[model samples]
Target: MTAPMISFEFFPPKTAEGLAKLRETRKQLALLNPKFFSVTFGAGGSTRDRTLETVLEIQSEGHEAAPHISGVSSSGEEIQGLLETYRNKGINRLVVLRGDLPSGEVSAGDFHYANELVSFIRQTTGDWFHIEVAAYPEFHPEARSPSADLMHFKNKIDAGANTAITQYFYNPDAYFRFMDQCQSAGINVPIVPGVMPIYNITQLARFSDVCGADIPRWLRLRLQDYGDDLASLRAFGLDVVTELCQKLLAGGAPGLHFYTLNQAGIISTIASHLNLQGD
Candidate 1:
């Protein structure tokens, strides 16, 4: 079998110190030779400038950069301008999303959904970008039903997204079942599994709650038992996540997209454990 493609996601840091640390982290991850390094757009386009700056710098470092763009709080003119800027800067990849609504925001601006954003990009930039949209193996939290969530995902794929990256999920069964559903629905685009290397149960619980990813009851209890013993927790988390990746790949996942949380230690270890080094 061919080696699976791998990618890493990062958020733009707000502080000078944080940015410096992220730069170092990227340097370490770069050795893994990911397909690209993606920088996230904050909720409602909050980190627009920082994201742009970070991606441009990554490009300068000679690595492919995929900057994310969220459509919920942005206007057509604004989105158009950003696309033009990235095209000019030679950034040819993007992760599109229906961004979180800014606290107390009433309108969804020009594009209300991620499918709209994908469609807009195609209209404005044609085939200039390789677009990736969000997918939810466990169903989106706000989705009214499973069928509705599948319909929404199909809409994004139909709107011109080249591929998708799923929300981080611990259960490989959930991913395989979602893939089966996508196949039945005739959605053929590559849908990469997102992996989150867990280090802290509390933080993982908070994220899982918001994103609708299920942490199996047994796994949660085991993690909780680790309590303040970070060393034991991390070791166990590493084993769990590494096994998860193995199962997904063995089951024919297209690739893996890691939610690195801007730290290299655990991610690096996981990649090594998976033998994800480039050929």
Candidate 2:
């Protein structure tokens, strides 16, 4: 079989030091020859400028870069300005999201759902950008039901999303099952599996809670057992995640999109384990 697509994600840093570190992180990950690097827009469009700067820098480095654009807390005018800015910069890809409202924020702005944003992009820019939308294999926390979540995802695709990148989950079965459902629903676009390299149990738990990604009972307990011994935890976590990636690839996943957390050590190790460099 041909090599599957590989990609990495990073959040824009708010400090000069953080920005310098991300530059190094990107440098190391670039050796992996990722199809593209994605820079996240913060909640409520908080990191709008930073995200744009990061993506443009990545593009200047001679690599493809995708910037996430959230519409939940933005006006139609604001979103249009962003689109035009990216287009002027020669950015041809975007990861569009409904995004999260900032703390204590009310209104859903002009676009309430991701589909609305996707529709807006198509109507405004035609096929200029390759749009990517988020997917939830374990069902979105706010979703009314499994069917409801599926319907929402389909709506995004129908609205002209070119592809999807799912929220990270440790369970391969969840991903395969989601793929089955999507196929049944006639959603054939490539839905790349999101992979989060485990580094800390506490941090993982916090993220899982918010995103509704399940940490399987066995894995959770095992991770917790490691306690403060980070070395053992990392080794075990590496083995487990690598195995999960192996299963997904062997089962026909189109690609792996890693939430690198701005660190390259673990992800680079995982890529080496998978021979992702075609060695």
lDDT per residue as tens, model 2, 14-60: 89999899999999999988889999998899999999999999999
- Runs with alpha carbons beyond 4 Å of true place in candidate 2: none
Alpha-carbon TM-score of each model against the true structure:
0.98, 0.98
Candidate 1, residues 47-122, lDDT tens digits: the string is: 9999999999999999999999999989999999999999999999999999998898888889989999999999
Q: Give the TM-score of candidate 2.
A: 0.98
* Model 1 regions lying over 4 Å from their true place: none
lDDT of 1: 0.94
